[model samples]
Target: MKSRRRWRWRWEHRGFALGLALYTLLLLLLVSYMLDYGARRGRALGDWAWEGQPPPAPPPGEAAAPPAPRHEAKRNESEDSDEAGPGSRAGGKRHIYLHATWRTGSSFLGELFNQHPDVFYLYEPMWHMWQALYPGDALSLQGALRDMVRSLFRCDFSVLRLYAAPPGPRDPLAPFLPGGGGGGGVNLSTASIFGWRTNKVICSAPLCPAAPRARSDVGLVDGAACERSCPPRALRDLEAECRKYPVMVIKDVRLLELGALLPLLRDPELDLRVVQLFRDPRAVHNSRLKAKQALLRESIQVLRSRHRAAEPRGLPRRHPLLPPGAAAALAGVHPRQQHRAEFFLGGALEVICQAWLRDLLFSRRAPAWLRARYTQLRYEDLVLEPRAQLRRLLRFADLPSPPALEDFVLNMTRGAAYSSERPFLISARDAREAIHAWRERLSREQVREVEAACWEPMRLLAYPLSGQEDGDRQEGGTVPLQMFV
Candidate 1:
């Protein structure tokens, strides 16, 4: 009986020991789980705090880097008007900028690059890619930059809709810019290939008269407002396109005003290369007459209630340098007399010549940025020897001329079918009299008027017009503007 009781007590003690061991194991597991869970939660919270949101899927086939907090990885630089500003274009040090003038053969240049297998050329991007995010003053440097970034990421459909809606006098972009108009849908094709949204010249795209019922609508824009607000986008898109080709070309014709273009394009990261194409004064006069007539027609076509006769303004005053030979002969005319003189002598022709004379200097004294980035080219050289000229240009820009770039050149040379210059096309023929075309293109009286108007700008540009006596009559009818040697 005593032995049995001792054995039973020992068994009871063993059972008690087993229960305590099981309890201890469970407590240890619970503490370990709590610690592990806390660690994971801390890590996730830390990541969220740093990164604004989950990183987007990387570009196809490229590894997406882990997103740092939006604050951590973002750069704080000079304020840009919208997204895709200099920072975006410099997407890690690759950038290109093309500065070509209107009719300086830039459209052909655009075609030349757009044909490249690796190149995706964007035309006048400054005018085409603008998406004004809100209704207010035109895009500020900061505002433009931010909105461009938003364009890259999906926009608030509502904002895009508002930007797209048009037909109002004060375009949504008016506050941000001086003129009007905006681009249509984003070019998803460009974004997919080169990671950018690019457009050509900024023009009004006809869209159905639609209003944004919800956020999904991005309609078309009015035309003029586009001019005022699109430059930043053009600059931004060109900068992006350059990343892929590292050689982008652009021609913003609206940049006719120096006040509109230079500051935005002066960014160092853009690697801008400008080409100031020129023609002889004779050729300039010819082109100006055509341009004047065309503009006059355009004004008539767009004859708004506020018709301001869209004729070219004091173009002579625009330049500080006039040629000494052609212009110096007229230095004695007065201002009021010049306007009156236009009717008696070709007043229109005098205005053009004087403006051109002043521009020669103005072109030279352009801002340091343009001066540093540009190379001058003549129109004749571009047309006659495109390949050779392009090669030299490539060399200047530190780019290798491709073996088959001649193919591109052929397209430019052979693409357009313009009629050979007719006598009337280049200039009005000397009716019956042996016309001293240059001297007679503008009357002495008209020349005198221009001399006064063009003198100030001509002086600023240090224009040394060829100080030669105007022969009352050249031996034959010759336009002295050209060096026909």
Candidate 2:
């Protein structure tokens, strides 16, 4: 009887141990699957990605090495060399950043670089970064933004993949249907994902033979393939090409705080030159208002369409279910929405004026080394005398004043007429008219208000206040206080 009891106990215990081991193995597998799923979801969701705390820094000795200066332009090259053979990556590269705010003629300036066969131009790579961290969440976001830019400069476009992913189906019901049948789904073309004009120009350039072929069959390949194949290779070739080219230029309007990018300028590896572009405050404000109005009209139309669609489901005409904060957060992602939100929040003009003041002060206070790399360019000056200003700019950047450069400027400006309200198109017509057009557009009171808020910076930047300012102060009692609507 004792032998029999011992055998039974042993059998029970062995069975229980086996069961426990199997359960543990199954649990481990399940956890691994969950982690993989979460990572894939994160890549697809962009801003909604589960970006927990930032990763810890590497140990002191393991940190990344600073970039080395790779290329230096040859001053002895003939002017015709500008149109010569494929750009060589044999020497150190020249990097130029054209920093500006909205409504400034930065697009035109950027195009000047774009037209150069030897120059590889990037248009607002930071636009994706801004969308990912909209409303600028301060230190963390700022650090991320700078890091993204650093990666781009070094020819690593992997960071951009975070924002390049196509958003998953927003409507739940569509997934159940064949072909994910949602009529209004987000369609992200290669051109749209990358900039339209920038992509067109880059593809046609000699370095990217694969690009033009890929463009013809854009629908066949997925975004992932395009992301994998094009940007990385293009950037790599450009990095190599930089050795032969005089300069590589990047233009961005979102960099309102120039001081934040001081690290890049100070980097010994990067021969970075900064061109600070500013427009008249009044013109900037007016352009912003016009854009906001157009966007608001579009938003209203979208809301109405949603209301019509919801009627069959017995839903409210307005999306009353969303909290104000949630709606505002959604709106904040887009520039136009942010503009409207700011207008209602008041002090829109003050905000623009303050930005001008802050940037001017930051530029003025830059250290000697940084100041050496910096050059200020006014929109008025660029527009008024394209050839002379561009010649000066190229010389400052150490680029040859090739005849091709002259042809590019004349072709770009004369081909498209300049319009303050519509700045995307290049206009060669009298740029001076666009300069002070804001004076006539803004009312006397509005002009006075802007001038009052921005007098110091305006004076410092050499922008004269309208003579009507004195008259407005005298009639201050009767003049209704106006704000940006």
Best by TM-score: 2
Question: Candidate 1 lDDT, tens digit per residue, 209-299?
Answer: 1212211112222323434333333334333333333334434332222222333333333444555444333333333343454334222
Error of 1 at 429 (Å): 22
* Per-prediction CA RMSD (Å): 22.2, 15.3
RMSD (Cα, Å) of candidate 2? 15.3
Q: Worst ten-residue run, lDDT, model 2? A: 476-485
| Residue range 344-452, candidate 2, lDDT tens digits | 3224445445545656655554555556677887666666567887887877676656676676565544433335344343445445456656766766555555555
| TM-scores for every predicted model | 0.40, 0.57
Best by lDDT: 2
